[model samples]
Target: MQSLSNRLQTQPDASTATALLQLQAQVDGDPSPAPSSDLDGMSLGGLKRKRCRGDFEVCALGGEVGRDVVERGLVTGEEAALYFGTFFQGCDKYVPVFDPSYDTFDSIRRRSSMLFDTIITIGCRAENGAVSSQYQALSNTTKSPIAEVLLGTTLPSIETIQALLINACYSEKGWMLTSMAVRMALDLELPDAYTQLCEIMLQGSDNVERERDLFRKARVWFGTFVLEHILSLDCGKRPGVRADGVAMRRCRVLLGSSARTTLDFRLLAQVEVCELLSSGDAGADVLLALAHDRLSPRVGVALSDRELGEIVQGTRIDLSIWLSDWITLVETAGATEEEKASLVVNLKIQRDWSEMTMLCKGLQGIGIDNVAIMSEEQRNLIRLAKISAQRHMSTIMSNTGLYLGGFRYGMDFVWAKCAFSVLLLLKLTRLLPESSNMPQLIADSKVLLAELSKVRGLNNIYFRILSLSVEKCERALKEDLAQAANPQNSGTQLNFPDAEMEFQSYVPKEFILEWSFPGLTFCWIPFDFQDLLMDFGSGL
Candidate 1:
């Protein structure tokens, strides 16, 4: 088990020769102010004095010392072994700086694959400890370090790296360390390290599906790992948590499943915080944040003075960062347009949809109340802002749909299907509000599904798409009916008061259910203006 401890390296690379020289000076601080005089140390007698214990024991103390002596000899071995035993432990750490074969090797460099195979074959032979020592005599003594330092450091040349591809060569714990390494590399822009790690994962395993399993099924465990390592309260667009200053992993969890046991086609989302609270799951909160962030930029017209009074206000958890994460996640989801459309439709039905709808309503309540005190001009600006926000949100919603619809990342996720349904539903609630042109929007959205149906394994997606569209159409009419029947006591125009009188009679639950999703119409709506997007944007 690789602990997060692997993320830290106390001896960060010394970038320049001066830095390296400074470090060497620090380590040799106690020895002497400068190299021992002896007139350039010419009288130092073959330099037997300075060596590490591992090297010293073999040369100094020629006899196999008793355990007691061995135990005693360990205190500052370099000092004790040389002074007490008249022998040395340390060897010069520097390997030779040149290799004779380098010139010839350059000609064979074009056959890099063959050269690598031969080198690995030699390494494998050295796997046995005895063979390793014997082989080290030949290669380390003759070629290896000198060759590498000369080729990599001394000359202006491409440094060749040895890498192999392995998929799912990682365990839940392994991924955490790997994730930290990846993040650190990304932050520092360490091209060499990042490339090295990506190569290791690619060569270590061939199971992409297993890799995804670690993504969804192990999120809780993964979250545990992340929380342990990543601890910073200053929330930002980029994850701020770090393991000893190394960036923590960014986790993506799938909450819903729509396919068979071995195949899970569902909503995949990047959730910032994975903890759960009575208020909601961190993942759920992330969706709410995404919705809000997506809506922030748009300025909408304000509500009438009377309507503004109804807006209830309270502080909400700030999720400005979540919106940015969502934006990137959704935008990168699908490789194509039709796939994107199917994803949008599927996302609309995700589990978070219903809850998100409610959450958005809460936001609307606060917003409306705040605007209630404003004049008509203020209300108009709010209205436009809301309208613009609704449009922008639709873009995110659409992009999310496209991504989820295209990727067939299999499902080993436990309880993911249910959770996904909830998110999709919540997302839909936020995306689809009562629109004046609900029928046209529904029609427009249908074309997206039709385009998506061409993709393989997406027939069911089209079916779900159809089901949700039918549901949206009926709810639009239902909303119209509800408003006409009991108009808001706050003065507003009534569309069909006569029809409203018989709304209960005109739109029975059973009749709507005959065509749309069960319980969909009444699921919930967050902000009334969301209806305007479905009604207007869809037709676009």
Candidate 2:
């Protein structure tokens, strides 16, 4: 049998749990010296597990953490409640998964130990070392003991899955944790008719029983599906859940809500995005024939300009229809001010992304060398891209809190939109050097990026890279423009036949590859561009 330690090592989402266990060992002054030999091939199951006698630390501030435990961590019940409210409330709004009315404190403590541990860990990290030096210390630790718990306990229950997801939402390493939760959820095989039948039979009232059990489970499963899909989409990976399986029409009936809520609309919008990006329908492929060829040079022959224009038009119409449906639903849903503002901004960001994708496709179809003398269709595509880029930046500025908090609350796609928008500006500057607004756009993006960097302990690596990449792109543009202004002072002779190709090559290929971002290596989507620019450093 696999040892507990080995099992914990295998689980991706167990980082926080594993770290806590290690900390507990250190705090208790574990006398068990480090291992003498590398037990690479040996199993550790035979070793006796250490049992700490101290009372467990309750993360909530100003709440009872039991009277007995020594070395109490800084968290009080009040603070823990706040973290839960901020990170999990968005989903709970629609699904009613964390309903306090139904979930008593004792019930949660007994049933959701894993969740309790996770919340405390997250609170420590978020505190930024203010409460104690250990908070900062725990924030740096990356180890997890997730496997031991999984092996030692019975198969995970739905309640356990719910806690794991809530924990994942607040975690810095969300994608890994969410991936593990997705697997466990699948293994649990939740929402089957047998469980619903049992609940109905037990309660003697189908409506009341279904409301408590069936609807609850359905909502939890939908939330899981939404997170799983969004994580996969943002990282450019194939989603683990089936899109058709979580259809909104069926979910609404299962939820039993009088009208669809904001959370439901958000989930539906995400599902649509997943479909839009990953759909393999023949019609979409035919529409994007040129883009398909540009993405993969092996196809050799590319589609004509007319064909590319037709594809862009088709994509626009599809996006329009998708937006209209969601807009109507959101307007009807009685959402709070914060929810309304965030949801509307999210939709706008998605629209901008869709517009950027289509326009870039059109630009690629025309061949970069000919952009200086563009056709009406090509110019329109460029114009649309610029407008969308500006709109995305402005939207983010207006709703700064939403996108910044997005890093912590499972709204990573919002940040991904911001990163992609910066790239769009880089592309525009490189292709349309003469456009007066490009310089102002680049400067505005830098200002916004600097503000994002101010976020305490931000975990998104790609977002950080935006600052460096933008600076490099701007420097390259300056050099190219200087050479153009004074050809006599150029340091080196240009060997390339076309100046446009030379200017295009200045940006590095490393930044363009989707896998350049962490945790995206396994993604097979054609969206990952290997290199749009050759060398931004060289003179055009």
lDDT string, candidate 1, 1-540, tens digits: 133324433233224233324334645664434333211211121122221233232122112211222233322333322322210000000000111223123332342322222233232222322134433342222233223222222111111111000000111122233333333232232323322333335466666554443333232223322322221111112222223322222223232211111111122232233222112323322233333333222456434434332321111222323334554555555435553444334333332332333233333433433332434553443333334334433543456444433322211110122222332333333333434344444454455445434433243333354445445445655666666686663244323233222321222332222111112222222244455557788895
CA error at residue 143 for candidate 2, angstroms: 5.6
Model 1 ranges with Cα > 4 A deviation: 1-220, 223-271, 275-317, 325-355, 358-393, 396-440, 456-465, 471-540
| Predicted candidate 2 versus true structure: per-residue lDDT over 188-253, tens digit per residue | 544343235334444556475455555455555556665655444344454554432222333323
Query: Which of the numbered candidates is closest to the native, going by highest TM-score?
Result: 2
TM-score of 1: 0.27
The local distance difference test score of each candidate is: 0.30, 0.49
**Alpha-carbon RMSD, candidate 1:** 23.0
282: Cα error in model 2, Å: 12
